[model samples]
Target: MSLLLDGVTVGYRGRPVFEGLTLPPVPAGSLVSVVGPNAVGKSTLLRSIAGLLPVAGRVELTGESLTAMPRPERVRRLGYLPQTLPQAVPLVAYETVFSACRSALGSWTNADTEAAIEAVFDRLGIRHLALRRLSEMSGGQRQMVGLAQVLVRRTPLLLLDEPTSALDLRWQLNVLSAVREAADAQGAIALVASHDLNLALRFCDQLLVLTPSGRIAMGAPEVILTPELLASAYGIEARIERCSRGHPIVLADQALSTG
Candidate 1:
């Protein structure tokens, strides 16, 4: 249920982004959120865990090493929905997501596939756009399609890259709540990269705040979302407050001073 990385270092073509990024041992059925300055390798970390990028560390799920595993094998256990869903081909929105299981869903009839696809669309509130082409949809709509593709995957480990960026406020809460429901009902572990700090604190059981320099700042919301950490990571004076329900909120105190 947990996705553990030990001394993880990720890079591209020999150019490093993060080094010695050791995450603590998180228990099962946990939702962990990662927030950092733009281009701090947040997406790269997600890609590395999903097997889309190679790294010089161990990524394990429930004590099982995931490095170098075959893509199909990994797909059975891990579901990845990237933030940017490039139109790989001129695909109808429904068809693109249905193709995710094209390899393993061989024997299922077209009717069955359609039914399954419809269910996914219905879950994400996008069933009405079944026949539309991907290129014609707005950025937010296309992002939902990408998420639907991964949600179609009934796996234990879910990796979402900026799941709420393109989504509006309501969908942001909806999608993150969906992640929480998945963990509660199915005993799943989710690693999410998100920009909305409040949603992350509210929905995620744990927080993994990556610094602007790509260092690891891991803990619960209260421990990790302090003014000191915010100032260090985002270079802004911020105060972390607690709501009546005990959830956290970050109040930015001042703009940066160019000294």
Candidate 2:
């Protein structure tokens, strides 16, 4: 399975942010990180691929055009977590996640839904929050609940927009680890949009870099995340080094003079 983008064009107000952009096919069972400076089209790209935004070219999954699929079928095939978390309603955390899976299945029984919800909650280590009302939870707790909702859907294509934004350091690693495990276990294609360079490099298998000009570069993180590329993309002088554990770490020493 693969997700392919061919000549994709997206914009707002009739002004093109990126035109005729084509990406290499992202293989299934892989976790890829989409990284770029703020205001680049990273989120837009995910939204366009999720069929939330109108796009000009083709977005395909496993040789089938995603846009041509019915709305429900499309929904069943892809899971999208937006940058903004949902508003706190008078709903419990488990109920929200269970409802997401129920909606996807359309006619699943309560027993089945409960079983699925429990499995997801356990996987995310949020079983304790099962009965907690959304209104009573903190922002980070709510964010984790939102992630559980997405994970319960079991969609083959997962688009996560800053899923770790509201999370603490521990939950950041936990969420990314769970996502990677899901992709590996289910053969899903996961694209995560994040601002944390080290996190992306550490957890993701492939890096899709959205340059400041809306151009893209794709490869292993170590190869693609050079000082020159960092300077060009972020206007920073960065040093890519290995920590004590021998993992790559990017140290940005100074901001470049772009003017």
| Model 1 C-alpha lDDT per residue in residues 1-259, reported as the tens digit of each score | 5777888888987888877778887776888898887888888888888888877888888888888777767888888888776564568887887787565556667787778778778877888777888878887888888887777665788889988788798878778877887788778888899887888878888888878755568888877788878877788988888889887788787967747
How well does each candidate superpose onto the true structure, as a TM-score? 0.89, 0.97
**Per-residue lDDT over 1-259 for candidate 2, one digit per residue giving the tens place of the 0 to 100 score:** 9999999888999988779989889999989999999988889989999998888998999999997888898999999999998678889997888778888888778887788788889988999999999998888889999999998878899999999999999999999999999999999999999999999989999998988865588988999899988988898999999999999999999999967
Model 2 Cα shift for residue 153 (angstroms): 1.3
Which residue pairs of candidate 2 clash?
Answer: none
Model 2 superposed RMSD (Cα): 1.0
Name the runs in model 2 displaced over 4 angstroms: none
Candidate models: Cα lDDT each = 0.80, 0.91
Cα lDDT for residue 259, candidate 2:
78
Q: List residue ranges in candidate 1 displaced over 4 A.
A: 88-90, 104-115, 243-246
